[model samples]
Structure formats: structure tokens, C-alpha cells
Target: MEVLVNNKLYAVQQGITIAALLQFIQLSAHKGIAVAVNNQVVPKTAWDQQQVEPADNITIIRATQGG
Candidate 1:
């Protein structure tokens, strides 16, 4: 299946969860991060339960240490 991630198209295996997607992208879950699917914010608790679909738009934001 293909999904739009941060405005870029990516091909991923079916039945992958948000948590897995993060891992696949080599993002650390320990860091504070935010995720939005189809323009709706998805809570961290739902990452494991949320399933990504083809053509789905996913946005991920992380807190940066800078002033």
C-alpha cells in the first residue's frame, strides 16, 4: 500500500500500524512526537491500534531543542 507521509509518497506493507511506521522511518518513539492522520491528530496511545491505509496522509512532528 502507498501512503503520503509529510507530503511524500511512500510504499509500505499492508496492516502496518502507526507505531511500526515510525520505526520503519527510523524515528525514536522515546522522543516527544506528534502524528496526524488525514489531518486528524492521533494520540500516542492509538499508535499501536491505528492502521494506515493506501493514499492516507500522515504527518509527523517532533519537538526540537532550540530557542
Candidate 2:
């Protein structure tokens, strides 16, 4: 299946959870990361349980430590 990540299309396995996707993307340390699915923000506590649907719009943002 294909899902939109940060406005770009990326192929992913079916039934992939947000937590899995983050790991696949190599975000080993996601302390400052935030995710949204289909325009709705998903709390960090739900990443492991939130499954990505086909064509779902997923956005991931991470905080940087620069002023």
C-alpha cells in the first residue's frame, strides 16, 4: 500500500502501524517527534496501535535543536 508521508508518497506494508513506520524510517530516537494521520493528530500513546490505511495522509514532524 501507498501512503502520503509529509506530503510525499511512499510504499509501505499493509497493516503497518505508525510506530513501525517510524522505525522503518530510522527514527531510533523519537522524543521530539509528532505525527498526524489524515489531518488529525495522533497522540504518542497511540502510535503503536494506529494502523495506516491505504492512501492515508500521514505527517511526521520532529523538533530540531537549533535557534
**Judged by TM-score, which candidate is best?**
1
Task: Give lDDT tens digits, candidate 1, residues 1-67.
Answer: 9999899888999999999999988885647799999999998999999999988999998888888
Candidate with best lDDT: 2
Model 1, residue pairs in steric clash: none
Task: lDDT for model 1, please.
Answer: 0.91
lDDT of 2: 0.91
lDDT of 1 at 59: 96
> Per-prediction TM-score, please?
0.92, 0.91
User: Taking the tens digit of each residue's C-alpha lDDT, what string does model 2 give over 10-64?
Assistant: 8999999999998987875779999999889999999999899999999899998
Q: What is the lDDT of residue 5 in candidate 2?
A: 91
